[model samples]
Target chain A: MSVVRRSRWSYLSLQQAPLLLAFVMLGITVAAYVLFFDLRLHHLPTAFAWDSTISNALPLVFVAAGQGIVVLTRSLDLSVGGIMDLTNSLAATHMHSSVPSMLLWSLIVLAVGGATGLVNGLLVTVGRLQPIVVTIATMSILQGLAAWVLPQPGGNIPASYTNILANSNSPLGLVFIGVVAVFWLLLRRFRLGIALYAVGNDAEAANALGINVRRIRTSAFVLSGIMSAAAGLFLAAGSSGGDATGGDSYLLASFAAVVLGGVSFFGGRGSVIGVVCGAGVVTLLVSVLFYANVNSFYESFYQGIFLIGAVLLGMVVTSLAQRRARGSLRRSRRRW
Target chain B: MRNSLRGPRSSVLAIRLAVSALVGVLMTAGTIATASASSLAAGKDAHFTIALSNSYIGNTWRIEMENEFKSACKMAPIKTAVNCSIYNANNNVPAQRSQMSDLIASGVNAIVTDAASPTGLNSVVQEACARGILVVSFDNTVTAPCALKVNEDQYQMGYLWAKWLAQKLHGHGNVLMVTGVSGTYVNEQRDAGAQAVWKKYPGIHVVDQLNGQWDSEVAQRVVSAALPSLPKIQGIWCQGGTNGVLKAFQQAGRPLPFTAGEAENGFRQLMASGKVQGYSIGQAPYLSVVALGLAYEILSKHLSAAHFKTYNLPLAPVAVQNSNNVKGKTWFPSLGGDFFADVAQTGTGSTVAGLCLASAKSGTACPSGKLVFSFH
Candidate 1:
């Protein structure tokens, strides 16, 4: 009887590699964090509670999640932060007097975000430009437009809206959960999701298999844009209005979070769950550093160092696991 | 790829998806029930919103300005309290002008500004005033005539520096003057005041003048740079705060060079640290809050000139120092130990007696052995 088996190359090329690696990296990061900060089990609560420093990180989590999706599709959304900046102002300006009125304003702002993302999609796929340059241009344009919209970091997001989004955990968290679940289901079963994966894995092969590469990539960007906008609106819930400078710092953090999540810079292999875990670790690390009274300047440098160490640990762990499995296989085959 | 494009081509399916998404957004917004009406006094005839535009919260002085301004807002009449909000331009003048327009659109009744550049902001000043929005500028004066100008007399800042330095050195020394941004309002007056007073004291020579640009770090570098160039630099007359100067000198291993500075907490801290010669002129930006109070009074015509004068609100003066003469003058917190004692009265006797050349009037400045509370 002929035994059908996967090749070693196939195992190395599998998308699961990035996911497994991300999980291991996250574990190592959490462990190292516990050691560096001297954070004992007694310090942690049964459930994560939102506080001032943690709240500052919500937008970072949101944007990083969106960027994670984009990264999984072998692309990056450079305009996420800029799109955030634009939408924040749009929400602030249009959302006039009263909670209901402000929410309607946010919806309008979200639509604007969708539209902006669509523009980026058309530029990259239809125009056939590099994602980096395309987004760099849109980033500036969106930020400029934001400054034009709000001018100064003034205006109110209305207590009714911010009170719920920033302070209260009403249905927003549930909706966030819903978004993740829906995304997971789509990735697992939906045609569009499969096409997206196929394109990211190998665009030419996907094309030969009859996938419209451009369409998949464009749709990926659109999803990314929407997520970024949602994150912006969420952040506006915290500031309760618009700040033109508010979203800028998040751009770098999102990119860093994606990379730290064990997502390859080359892309095509990552999961939302991995990215979310990465965000949790980064957020926890930052807040712990703050509570530890670390100097403000060293924060970014420490995070970078942590990333380097996490990546190295991931590589070592994966290699060791591979060697162990190989030894086990040889032993079993020899016995046979 | 062509085959994939044909898979989802039903127009009806696309329409259903689009409609469903719209519904999703609508339902989500409805659930959130977010409020907007961005005004504190919505649909109220008596109350009004006022926008306060600052160039930047660039220093500790600006921070204190904010602290005091917020405190003063609480002191306002509850019913007609000014709905004041601040727009920090982050040191961008053009950005500030654009902010001014946003404020106008937001329906703020009055604006109190610290002009980023006195000349360039005229157009916005003109536009704001034309819209019947009262404009008052403080800290930095507007070249275009605004209704009220409330700022520390810049000349007084320099004159006091020179006087204090000359006295500290027994009326004879090579003095170093560290001024702020060269072409602006404050620097010009401060330089002129220093030069004018130092001309009378032939022995008090003006050896070197450097623009410290009102930044503590810059002040430090300039003072350090100029120290070696001076011939036995008997005194240092800093037109602005000298916390930076003291820090730089200390860090550079340079001993005390008889310094005078803007009366500020920085100077007080420097004095307390025993690093500075201990004299500064504090410009309370909270004066503008008072100016805002005055502007509202003027606009509502609630008080006449006499009644306004009777309000007894003026620039609250406090000399930054460690002398017994400057103790208990202002709200001296723990760190300000003996710093503000008689600080308000620093320029009182000198202003009347002409003893302190920094005072604008002869018999009204601080007496001998007392420092004058002058603005920079």
Candidate 2:
């Protein structure tokens, strides 16, 4: 009876790892905010501070959410940054003052994003190309196209549109986040989502179980592309302009967010909610450092160290839990 | 498998080699055009070939500077007397150094550069000067004594602005300072200048400071974020992105304070409309043309090298005519919000520096004459 109980406890811990990591990240974000507030009473953020923080994290959050799905299927989308640049350029160049024009251009941006993803999916699935090579090649092509479309960063984005997207009181930003969350929940209920996990765990076994591994992988890339485009729109809205090279920094940050959120780089782990929290943690770290009056030159260095620490801590916890479980299993076997 | 890959790899290598060879040949041909165009200084009928090597073309200011230089190249006596080539590197110091080296190799009579580094390109500048090539470094200049320098006193630009803000606030108020990109020499010097002036006035309290990155968007975002955490501000001292700083105040529903900012169109517009009380100053885009004119004068032996080894161009305080109308001669009512409005062709005569806003924008050749340099 004791052996069975011990095994159950270990199984529960294994299942709870990602969720536990997310809670820890959320705790860190709160502590950072409190420290930032304590630096000066006047520095205390307003009631809507959370809203603004969410808005700031929206771009990375969206990308990480999609990346979480892709990682679960054991694939990576390196082309997300390129897609973002292309989308940002399109929005800045075409989205004008009129409401109808803005709506029209936004749809066109989404379609372009989806089309780029479709191409990436087809290359990976149908062409049997390595995902990294195919995505990198596509990223280069998209970057060149972005540069061709808008050579410089100047474009006229209407103030009204920017205000709506950037305003803390506005529900528009929340709506975008909510849509992503709801989509992830609905995806969890679908057969494709289950197939993603199964294929990631063991592709041959999943194939033998009648799962279309190729289709699942292709769908993951498509979703990631769409998410990156949406993030690009958010960035365009925030900056009220276009920069072809601005999205370059997000490429690495997204990977860091994914790993920090407890998504295994190897495959078959993590959740969308955890990824969002991971993005929040990364953004909050920067804000905390900024408010703490750290030199801007050293900010990037501290961010790098924090990311490494989070990843290493996650690895340590996982290995320790696994070792304990293995020891318990041996003792149980000996007693039997 | 290795043999199969080798077939495509070798073909790719061959294609790359062919492409590089074609590029090399075209570059040589282009350089030859400039080299052969240089006329003897003895003959008024001959034209001098000059090349402008700019390190970064990522900002509006650089674009405007390039346009001004191009227009000046096409303008009058210079147009008939000078041929100009422009090369831009994307903010890489090594790349710019190599580009300058290539310009030196092209055998141009003069090379004008807006350097990427103050010291990184000193060796290249020295080499160019040693080759009898007139090298003039403008904007972010080099430290090489051989290269002629053309720039505004950046420290004074900051000092004057801070002095103005201190007086406007009666030397007693909480001020928020918005700075440019950190670790940049310009940003550091400007901060030091401001601090020097502020230290003189014990009442003038700087409540907070933040990096605005010399970018309007970044300035707006950071200022907006910092607003909720600060006390009431009576003054703002911004190195750049003044317009964005003002926009942040507006968004936060605060009254406009006494502001000293760089010359941006939106900031000038606000000042002209009486929405904000401030002074605007800028390192003019026309400085490039000024530098080029200096280079030409030196090359033609019209000016003494000793007189212009180190030149400080006058920093003009952008004048605002308090008219609600944007039709003031100094500010444009029709141009985009990002256009630098203080652009004027300054020299001895109308014929020599006859640069207009249209010519600067369109790169059309305007009439040129001899440019008199005010050496200090």
Candidate 3:
């Protein structure tokens, strides 16, 4: 047998180094929250501290997950905010209290998301334009459409829809997070999942291996678009209303969450699980700082410090793992 | 054995590190650039915790609003009786929601807020109200029925401005209406009020309407661009950025028109100097102080829930008669153009009376170190 297996630690470390930072950061923030605040676990049922955090963070989580997928394929979707705006406005304005109307509009809103994503993918792949440029242009267009649809921030999202989707009074929000995780897990076993990594790792190499690089890349965007649309629906539910420009802040926030979640911006090397934890870190830090009673002026300053520290820690750990893996390979070869 | 990871992996790592740093820096920089107010520790004698949950802090008006809040906290009655903290959400609804949730969890007795959206914070605000927390919103107020509100009648401000302009034009003139940002509750109400008044005067033709975005420079640029093709403007009805409109007219070599707009110092200065004739009224930044006062009164049992209805503040009287009239109170020569002249009010038994230039400018205590707060 010519094959020599490398050390298991080296293998795990190379693939999962960023997850370590994410989980550790999540743990620290959650612990700090409890320690600083009067977070009685027994009273959590009524306190709504945990429930509201989960509910409020859900939209950003969905947006980050979609951003993570596009990132895994070595591309960026600047139009995530724009797509979210349009779908959010659409859902808020159209959905009434009736189940039939809600259901019908839900499907329509999702289809609109898919259509917008397809346009972005097509423009990037067929037109051979820069992903950034194409997405930026589409983002502006979507924002305009959203503004035209709502014009102002006065649309009604049924109370029932909000309770079912993002209720701060119940643990229903955790189930949605689970759905995203399960979806990603199932996706990892699919052919498209493997191809996304390969394409992101090296597009030319992926092409040589008989993979349709353009199609794979475009599909990644389509999926991202659908996910972003879902994010819009979640946002409408959370706010129970709509604002045309509400999606503007989510653009930078999604990017921040994706990066913090250990998803490589260079593409192809992170899991949605880690991304969830990353989203948790982003959301919970606010509460942690609040309970710690850090002056609001220093809140952002502390957030910056923690973000930089986590990224640096992940990088350091990753390089150390790379060195260990290379060493193990040399040792195994010598033994052979 | 060949390396499975192709390409310059080290170079890739370097670039990845750089990109991550850039994202982090950008996020941090975006937040740090905004003005920030301090938090007051709950003194042992304090009976309640009142937090000011503001939405955005990018512009001067918001900055002044926050400063005025901080100044109010330092005064005699509020300083000893209530513990105050301020939080800015940078206009992100989700972030604001999170802050509100945390404030609720922290068990604050009252939240004085300027909401990010009129309707977005309704559910959370309702939750707060259900939990027996008093929620008072001013400026961009929330739509939740449970919440108490303190604000000037925005529609009335617009009506008064337009009525003044129409009268100046003798009910017949080419009027250019410079509006604030669209899609805002304030802008909508103000515009509607002005249009209502415009309808009554058939000869007051609103030749064009441009969005000033409520900023001085933006108003100047848009008005300047439209000046070339516009007919002689006999009157100007502006929601904000009034000084910018005058500068645009000045730069165009056109005679300054009779104008009615927000109470920026520069606009009042021009009026005092006899350079232009105009009427000004403002959504006073001190509304925050009033909201805080209302919240404090409710918490301290000085005012009952019966007094919990929307408190509509009267607009400040824009004193632009001469330099001496507005020198220290209405228009400060030492202050910049973007400064709101109506930061403090006196002689009105409102919460913001007795506030001084130092109080609005630097969050300092007045010489008297006393605050007069009336429920009415």
Candidate 4:
């Protein structure tokens, strides 16, 4: 058997299309800022802008990345929002000014998130339940639990927590984002990562190859839960409080980020890198619209239009590449 | 070719579903509309830019609240002195925070807000305060210590309503407590106040408590469901969706009990028609106008933020005895059941009074074409 080799450029243009889309989205965000504020490129990256934008978008970034993982495994976790709400409630209610309590409660929150994910994973794999049904049920249960933990939208998250996690005066939170990216990069090299892609590509094939499909799928969910918990902690920090229902908004937005990131819902494709940028795009678009002074009533209209446009653009690029590849293959066949 | 065709087709379907879902999410992310009227006379120089950053606009009360602010901006002094903008965040905390950041960046003189969360906006509100921008939050006020708040005491609203219900029952009755959305600051405060009043009247028993969610449809459903299980609810103390609760009683063919609830149009209509005897006190929609006026007062007058304290506006309780006040000014007969009746101040004061229904419905100026807001 002979193997065919492709150039780096070809692989990047075709396989890494999501990154390209992310770049386009980032471009639009920058253009929106410049056009609306009438500022030069040099004036774009202020510490204050970075601080506010990154801090606010940080929670979404983690959530979308977790969602990206779930999507990669061809599953949906509707309970991400509920998990976020529960963990946020837990962190806000228990985390004190002391470092030990903060650390201790943080672990507890993460553990709770993992436990919830385990439940989802077990139900999906062992119980043979649909992912959507399982997650929807878990979502409701988690939201109720969140309300039980913090009956009202009141919790004393210390100023030190806010400063350390998501300070408004500094863009230090970007370091945490970098850490998430690095974690994703490292995971890509592991056996579990390969198994995730293989199982998502084809469950039967993966099982035949002895890849432990159930375990891989379960691990993906566990990772997603941990990430969502991290997101909740960041949300609590950003808001400087705890709210039982606060995580409700992040649910749909995570799916939006996954789609915009060009992560195929069919599974076995895309990167969390693009998902992070997609989260940024989702967030930056709001600021861009605000600065552009678009009529408020039509804000959602524009957002929908933009999402469709981006998806269409991705499809067009992919189809063009596919046609080019087919043409080359036909020419080679004739020559042979 | 079949494989490729089917792949793209199914993927397209998935993408469409995702797109529509995203759109649905965006639709509720809120609108950022600039309501800066350009037809101002060119004589006065004291200009201030005040923005109303509201949390949700899905309900009638929120719409009326925003309309009042716009109407105020178009009237005499505010029209000339203030350039107003309105934004709705659809009850999303992050969305509101980003809007707050933008409002700060734009360097608006003041921001009048009905916050999504009491503490969710504390960080951004603090940033705004540090920037010397006056932040006045009304209705669902913020927990930011630096921001000025203008709101009717939610506790007082519940306390007064419960007190009225207790009196109507002669201090002995099975009253059903219909509370607002659970896990909310306002709902908790209001529920607590009502419970306090009930505790004093040992005979006044709260047999069942239902979560109305402050929506008419939900209130109707919950009240209807509970009516069967309940043993003769003698009095109804509804936090909101007053009309819906009454409609449930009517549908069930039960006698209309003495009620105390929000200033919904239908509730007032029932009282005016002698179909029900109750007290109506609303967490006024004009609270936005009040907050706007406060922001202007601090900005146009160059008053320091320290000069003002949390203005807990008095609740204007309209009793069932006052049928004359129900139809025209307090409650509009032409309006829908959900329309909040407490859109304008009924009495003469240095505050916003004499506002017409058009001001609440469509942001049109009153006949007076003048707005006055003075703290005395």
The most accurate candidate by lDDT is: 3
* CAPRI grade of model 2: incorrect
- Runs in model 1 lying further than 4 Å from the true structure: A1-14, A20-55, A97-103, A168-178, A317-336, B1-376
Q: Write the per-residue lDDT of candidate 1 for residues A31-57, one digit (tens) a residue.
A: 544443343233432222233223334
Predicted complexes: DockQ each: 0.02, 0.01, 0.31, 0.40
**CA lDDT of each prediction against the hidden true structure:** 0.60, 0.72, 0.83, 0.81
Q: How well is candidate 4 docked (DockQ)?
A: 0.40
lDDT of 2 at B288: 87
Question: Candidate 3 residues A254-333, lDDT tens each?
Answer: 88787788888888888777888888888887776665555555656666677677677677768767876777777777
Model 3, runs deviating above 4 Å: A1-5, A38-47, B1-37, B41-43, B316-325, B347-352
Winner by TM-score between candidate 4 and candidate 1:
4
lDDT of 3 by residue, B238-323 (tens): 99999998999999999998988888999988887889888878778888999998888788788986666799876544423343
* Model 2 TM-score relative to the real fold: 0.49
iRMSD (Å) of candidate 2? Answer: 22.9
Report the TM-score of candidate 4, chain B only.
0.87
Better of 3 and 4 by DockQ: 4
For candidate 2, what's the RMSD?
23.8
Residue lDDT tens for model 4, B1-376: 5665665576576557656754554344323323422222222654787888888888888888888887888887788787777887867787888888878877788889999888778888989889888899888888778889888888888888899888888999899989998888899999989989989999988899999999888999999998988898899999999999999999999999988998899888888788988788888888888888778777766455576678877565333344555568777788889988877777645366656788899988899988777675
Q: Is the docking of candidate 1 incorrect, acceptable, medium or high quality?
A: incorrect
- Candidate 4, superposed: residue stretches over 4 Å from native: A1-12, A39-45, A330-336, B1-46, B302-304, B316-324, B348-350
